[model samples]
Target: MRTAYSVEMVRAAERELMARLPDGVLMQRAAAGLAAACADVLGRVYGRRVVLLVGSGDNGADALYAGARLARRGAGVTAVLLAPDRTHPEALAALRRAGGRTVPGADAEEPLRRADLVVDGIVGIGGTGGLRPDAAALVDVIGETRAAVVAVDLPSGVEADTGEVHGSAVRADLTVTFGAHKPGLLVDPAREYAGSVRLVDIGLAFPGEAELEALQHADVARLLPVPAAESDKYRRGVVGIAAGSSRYPGAAVLAVAGALRGGAGAVRYVGPAGDAVLARFPETLVSTGTPEQAGRVQAWVVGPGAGDDADAVAAVLGTDVPVLVDADGLRLADRDAVRARRAPTLLTPHAGEAAALLGVAREEVEGARLRAVRELAERYAATVLLKGSTTLVASPGDGPVRVNPTGTGWLATAGSGDVLSGLAGSLLAAGLDALDAGSVGAYLHGLAGRRAADGAPVGAHDVAEAVREAWRDVTD
Candidate 1:
């Protein structure tokens, strides 16, 4: 699992470590790493045109020192100091001695336009709000050029803790981050600006758990449900799906399709679309009744195309087993009832649905997804899965929130979410907690979407069918 720390946490660790190390030791380590990453990106350092966007902070010092190293190796390095007087004194002297020229930030246009590589060291983790006007204009200049921008630590003008990009920010081809990952680099908006990230360890140790985590394939493999040799159909766990209606029966088929592939022993589907479910998956135990009459099930997946069936959704939530709510269920389910449930409740809401639940605009929820997920989880006292390009699973607990990175944009298609709901419900029935089930289900669903699309358009049914392949790929 790849873990990310908050800015406050990282700073504390850095301060503690810096106190123990010799003067300038940490900066030297960071500079060396930054220089190496720039060299790798340039392929050949000699004769490379390197321009540094020098700021007033340590980030600029890192860039200046790294620029000096490149200058010594025969690269033409120029430092465009945004704050000339406040620039790192020793770093400037070193760069001058190494034959690197320094220029004012306002006069950076020509050098920026023709540079082979532009280093963004304009802002650090402590930066808040957005970039100043001059910095924003410089960023605009960088954008107009073909230079491959490399940001030190993180992309300038983005919130290091929240992944929020207000006003303008630098878009880097590669970001050479130090020590550990920041929450911003692992999430969207800020993450999109970061492009490809390479972690450069500066030997800062963090205590306790990380603020955020992204599960790798090995972590997914460990959490996957593997049936025991002696396990029977009932023993493996059955997932009851309360979805689909006469108006939209395809949802039932798709949800059942995903459930069938989910490691669950059997899938019990209860809705008005029994014929549609039977037509697609003959193996599914079908019923045109409520969840209570749908026989025994370890978990229930409510809503996919149930329309305004709040009563039916409430019936499933009354059960003691883990329950997952999505689509119409997210809109219609009574909040009080959901909060009153004894069993684990998982709410999967897209930005719009989440906005409806929180009484905020969709943009607000989408902009601060980390805050939205955590607040939703805490508000309803249930696990909240905010589905998007970067899916997030947060529970009402102290553990790290899981951020899934396997998603592709093709998953924005219709019925894709229904497939995800079923798969997550199946995992819940198999006895994984709400957080694990949501995270693993999202992981598989995304991988399957990628596999199914393979750069082409794919239907939701294709994504559902590809779940088996995704499972095999993960476990392999």
Candidate 2:
């Protein structure tokens, strides 16, 4: 698993490491790594024009020290001082000693245009909101340049804790993060600004749980349920899907399609679309009744293409087994009832649905997804899987929020979310907790979408059919 720490945690770890080491040792280590990364980006560093956007913080010192290293290597390095008066004195001196000169921010346009690489150190993790007018002007100049940009730590103007980008921010081709990964670097919005990220070990030790966790292949493989030879169909687990109506019968077919391949022993579908579902999947145990009458199911999935089926939503919520509520169920499910349930309840909502639940606009949810998902989980007392470019699963407790790293734009198809709802519901039946089920389901769903699409457009059924392929790829 890939983990990210909050700025406060990172600072504490940094302070502890710095206390044990000699003075200036940590900064030098960061500078060495930064210089090496810059050299790699330049390919042939000799005679390359490198520009460093210097500021008043430690990041500015890092960039300046890295510029000195490049200068010694025959690259013509120049530091464009955003804060000329407050620049790191020792770093500036070191740059001059190594034959690198400084240029004022006012005269930066010419050098920025001619630069082969631009190092962004205008702001660091401590800086918040957007860039100041002077820094913004310099960044505006850098924007027009064809130079490949490298940011120190994280891209400037993006929130370090929650991946929110306010106004003007530096868009980097690559970001060299020190010590640990920030939450901003792993999520979207800010993640989009950070192009590609490389973590440099600066000897800081994180003591406890990370603020954010992203599951990798090994983690997912460990979480996936594999049946033993003695296990029967009922022993493996049965998932009950309460979805589809007269108007949208395809939703039932798609949901069952996903559940059939989710490592579950059997899929029991209870809905008004019984005929349609049976026609598509004869293996499904179909019933035209409420979830309670669907026999002994280990878990239930409700609310895909359910339309105005409020009774079905309420019935599924009342069941003792773990439940996944999505789509129309997100609208119909009572908050008090959901909070009162003893079993685990997972709520999956898109940005629009989440906004409706939060009484906010859709843009607000999209911009601050981490905050929105956390708020929803706390309010409903359930695990929330906010679906988007970066799917996030947040539980009610103080545990780390899980972020799905695998995803593709091709997942934005109709009925794709229905497939996810069933897959996660099946995992829930297979005995994984709400958080694990939601995150693992998202990981497989994303990989399946990528496999199905393969850079081309595909339907939701194609994605469902590819889940087996995704599972094989993971376990293989």
Q: Count clashes in each candidate, considering only residues at least 3 apart in sequence or on different chains.
A: 0, 0
Per-candidate RMSD, Å? 0.9, 0.9
Where does model 2 exceed 4 Å of error? none
Q: What pairs collide in candidate 1?
A: none
In lDDT terms, how accurate is model 2? 0.93
- Looking at model 1, which ten-residue stretch has the lowest summed lDDT? 285-294
The sequence of per-residue lDDT tens digits that candidate 2 reaches over residues 211-316 is 9999999999999999999999999899999999898888888989989988889999998999999988999999877787779999999999999999999999
**Candidate maximizing lDDT:** 2
RMSD of 2: 0.9
